[model samples]
Target: MTSLLSVTDLSRSPDLEEVSFTVERGEVVCVVGPPGNGGATLMECLAGTGEPDAGHIELLGVTVGPGDRRPPGLGAALRGEALPARMKVAEAMRLLSRLYGTRGLPGRLVDLLDLEPLLPKRFGRLTDGQRRRVMIGLALVGNPELVLLDDPTAGLGEGSRRRIEQAVDEVRAAYGGVCVVLDDLAQAERLADRVVLLRAGRVLAEGTPTRLIKLLGSTYVMGVPPHLRVDGLRDVRVLRGAAATYLYGSRPALEAAIQDLSPMSGDRVWSIRTPTLRDAYLTLSAVPEPAALEA
Candidate 1:
């Protein structure tokens, strides 16, 4: 019942206005916001990576210092930067051995990250997925109470992304700690128990993903089901209040839908977007539809 991280009246002016949230132990809170809207800054503040101009952060029942953006040392290193490319994977990990003051059980790390067969490989030799796993292993090695991941699957392939997501779930289950994932709705939905939508640095809404969908009046999605074809229409009336967007390839169809349906100039008419994580991402972060934008 104890709160792990509490932000009371937190404000990072010129950016984050006033922000506040409590991340209890064992909760995965996903924060989604527009680009350049301070989502990362908020995550850094919560993760002790950056300070808030005005706010108190209490972590694990203790008050932590203001945000520190000092040059990244261990985290960056584990992020797979700064290491000598030729260095053996084991050697790269061992470099931190002295700093951590523990001969980290490399074998265990390998096991936990499923890198046993990859231990002897050099940093330059591993595939993209293997490298990602290494960075993740290093980041979570300390076993902190609250873990923050910023765009954890930004560049990886679909298969690699799937692995990273599974790892996130494993970490949370293993630690029973709060994890705040900072990513677009695509990545966050995989791990979030609840999502907080931010706008101009302030929380616009907070609830479970399903609740957010309902709030946005999103369409029912069943994961890549067969496509629906609305034959030859100048316009088709959109289901009242559903948030779909017009997208590529269906231009002719969308035009037809619009032609057949009577649309008020002021009515907000959104076309269906391509089916992808980004579509869900857009829908996931949509602002409350204004009466004017709807047209």
Candidate 2:
């Protein structure tokens, strides 16, 4: 199937290098990476807000450029300040609809996003999380064929995050196109049909979440007391935190290593049954796990 959005060898300055990917219609693609790793820069380049020093981008089969023309039938909300400070929330929403020539704005969106209470408030007066809801709602105003959300839930409380996530889900259900950019790994795992993992200004890995999680295999984690001396432990990778040393590996090997501990009843212990997308990310990024650090 032809891609709805295709990026070829995209790069910019010291931030991005030869990044490339494709997004199919009705798919939600999440970009994940650490700070300054190009996730946000990728979004800006896609939204036409920033220019790429090299490479090309195609949205709906047309090349994107520095020209004033915006991609037709595409919607986006990028980082930085949002909305005119003095504009009321309701006015901002309506003005966006007018700009897109969208009529009969769905009342369900108002309720779905719980926008009623904030309607009369000015954009500058709303909290960061509230402004995020507005930004998401604004992106959906024209019911565009594609939407790009950059850190939509960044800084939100639990309730607000769920509301924004629900709005994203509704967009896919209603329009069947979305590319959600997120810094949070767990959120990416939950919402992504495909994931693009970036590190040090490059695309380190890209694939389905399930496939990526399997990169670490069927792993198990054993949490032992922080002070426990695990340097002598064999056939296990360990991640040490302030409270515990997390040892993980294939099931049988990990279990055998745990038995070697010969633990008493009071020893702190826990287990992670499935390897998560975050685990795969850390492995790919070459993070300094305890075992690697000791080596």
Candidate 3:
């Protein structure tokens, strides 16, 4: 089946390097990466706010190239964009709806984003989370066929982040369309139908959240002291962090490594749990070292 949105070999100087991906109908694709990894740049290119030095973007069968007008059905909520400080949320929504020629403020979107109570509040008076929700609503003004959100939940608290996640889900369900969200790995794990892991303006890995996690080839992760050594352990990958040294391997391998450890007075401490997408991201994005275990 043809994808709803396709980005091919999209490149920009010093930031994006031949980045590419596709979004299917009704699917939510999250581009996960650290800051300055080109995730935001990718969104800007797709939104037609930034031009790509090479390659092209296609949406709904329409090609968008450098200096081309934005496609008709594309909507974007980019970072650092703000509504007028004195404009009330309701006024802002109505104004964008008119600008986009949309019917009006969508009741479903208002409910999904919990914007009813915020209608009367000025943009400056609304909290960051509330303002973000309003921005998302503005982006959806015309029921766009493709939506691009850059770091939609950035700098939000855990509760606000969860609320945004829920809103994304509800909005997708209520209005069927393709969505592309650029955010951190944790948010990608929660919201992505397919995860695109980007690093240094390039794609490191792309797959479903489960598939990406499977790339780690480990069922469990054990966090031991950074100074502890497991010299005899095989088939385990070790990542040395400032706070803890994480060992990724199967359950039995970790158990064997634990048994081999010489009893240290009460000082020996370790923790084991299931591996997550963040663990996979860290492992894949890490620079190779002489002591690092290969998959």
Steric collisions counted per model: 22, 0, 0
TM-score of 2: 0.88
TM-score of every candidate relative to the true structure: 0.66, 0.88, 0.90
Candidate order by lDDT, decreasing, is 2, 3, 1
Tell me how far the alpha carbon of residue 176 in candidate 3 is from the true structure, in angstroms, after superposition.
3.4
Q: lDDT tens digits, residues 228-290, model 1? A: 333343323222124433232344555545444434223546445434434433543443631
What does the lDDT come to for candidate 3? 0.78
Model 2, position 223: C-alpha lDDT score: 68
RMSD of 3: 3.6
1-295 in candidate 2: lDDT tens per residue? 6677888899999899988888788778888887789888888889988888999888877788865456778888887748889999889878878888887247887777788899899999999888888887888888787888898888889988988888777777774578877889999999888898888778878888988876665566666778867776777887777766667787787777667775643463646466778777776676532121100
- Name the candidate that leads on TM-score: 3
lDDT of each residue in 1-295, candidate 3, tens digit only: 6677888888999899887788877778888888888888888888878988999788878887877887677778898889989999888878878888888656776777778899899999888888888898888887777778888888888766776677677656755454555656777887888887788888888888898788787899988877777555787888888787788888888877777664741546566799888898888878542121111
Identify the runs in model 1 with alpha carbons over 4 angstroms from their true place: 67-87, 92-112, 122-129, 217-259, 262-295
Q: What is the Å distance of residue 273 in model 3 from its true position? A: 1.4
